[model samples]
Target: MASTIISKDKFQFTDTIREHLAFGIVLTCLFLFLTSAYTKIEEHDRFMNGLLKVAFISHYAWLISWTVPVAEIVVSLFLIIPKTHKWGLYGFIGLMMVFTIYIGSMLLWSEKLPCHCNLLIEKLSWGEHVVFNLAFVGLAAFALWLIKNNQYKSLIKQNDKY
Candidate 1:
């Protein structure tokens, strides 16, 4: 019998699987943001109300509630193109982290947690929302790592051709 060893960086993903996973991560984020943007825009006042419960002040909450949807739309657009995908992923990760913190805080500190207005996430309990956001964070991180490694591999190949 022969024993084989796999490298840690591979994470058991073949090149094709890695590629698919990367695309899936990007697309999933894009879909999530696009749909969320639409819902937020459609239910703008409700979103503001939800934020008001979470935020310390109403005006600041209003501002955030408005800006968040626009940001989501922009991030979704940027994520589709290869040139902007890295930055999009970075933004996605940051946003997810912020959401995770916000949800976690709501669960811990807030006496009355605000209901979310987004489609799927809106319905989830705070703990479930945290888990969902954390999952996205992991996906974004993995996508980033995969993209960087692919670039590194390409660069090495180019050097070898010299």
Candidate 2:
């Protein structure tokens, strides 16, 4: 019985470590996006406008360019706050999905790919962009899994009380 309890505690400790790792991954991603948005706002805006014009979506290009950075900042804030973390993860996933789709589409159909994020990110090849986005998506998915698992475990414990 004592060993069983010790094993249980060890399991919980491991789970906690995983949870913290997920949180750290998410926080790092948040900072990455925020810094990318901040450092290249003008270039990003210009690139978006140019790409949209080329894609024939000129009407909304300006709006999207201006809004994307603000959205990223807001999402970063959400990820930093525990009460808002899940929502932040959702936002992060959505943004990454959109970015991935855009990069994928450009790679698939466009003659030339346009990058407007940051200097470091702009250097990534189109394929690398997809890989990078996918990695963040994986992180977000893992965080979501941890959150759901903890919630489920808590629910089970609550039910066991009766």
Candidate 3:
């Protein structure tokens, strides 16, 4: 019988970097995305109401609102999981795209509506909002590139041979 050892180098550089980047991005996004909710815990109801209006307030609104933070945490964990992280990264990219669009649309559509949830809106403007969204788009693009690269082929083959 022959002895063999599996090592981290078995995976291609692209896959390794993407996997790590995906995990990092998920954590960063979860923290940055939910920051408003965390900071405005005092106004949780208003925050929920805003989302409810955008997403339709049905019987599930109450539960969904409360679970959103928890759900973000779960998704972040999934992105960090070795077996499930690839697919989870794809989902994370999609989520970021949707959020970018949603926030951008809101900014464009509302010219003078009273800001509800953003605590530091007095310092914000339409341009700043767009710039913020653009930053998210850039991050999403980097993550998406990794997903499309398909960098695991080498690692998978190396493992099979070993």
Judging by TM-score against the true structure, name the best candidate: 1
Q: Pick the winner on TM-score between candidates 2 and 3.
A: 2
What are the per-residue Cα lDDT tens digits for candidate 2 across 31-146?
A: 88778778657577566756585474457887777787888888999988988888899999998898888778777778755556666577788798899889989989888778
Q: Give the TM-score of candidate 3.
A: 0.54
lDDT of 3: 0.58
Error (Å) of candidate 2 at residue 55 is: 2.0
The superposed Cα distance between candidate 1 and the true structure at residue 100, in angstroms, equals 1.1
Question: lDDT of each structure?
Answer: 0.82, 0.79, 0.58
lDDT of 1 by residue, 91-128 (tens): 99988787788777778878887775579677787787
Off by over 4 Å in 2: 1-13, 42-45, 48-53
Q: lDDT score, residue 119, model 3?
A: 61
Which of 1 and 3 is the better model by lDDT? 1
Which candidate would rank higher by lDDT, 2 or 3?
A: 2
Question: What are the clash counts of all predictions, listed in order?
Answer: 0, 0, 0
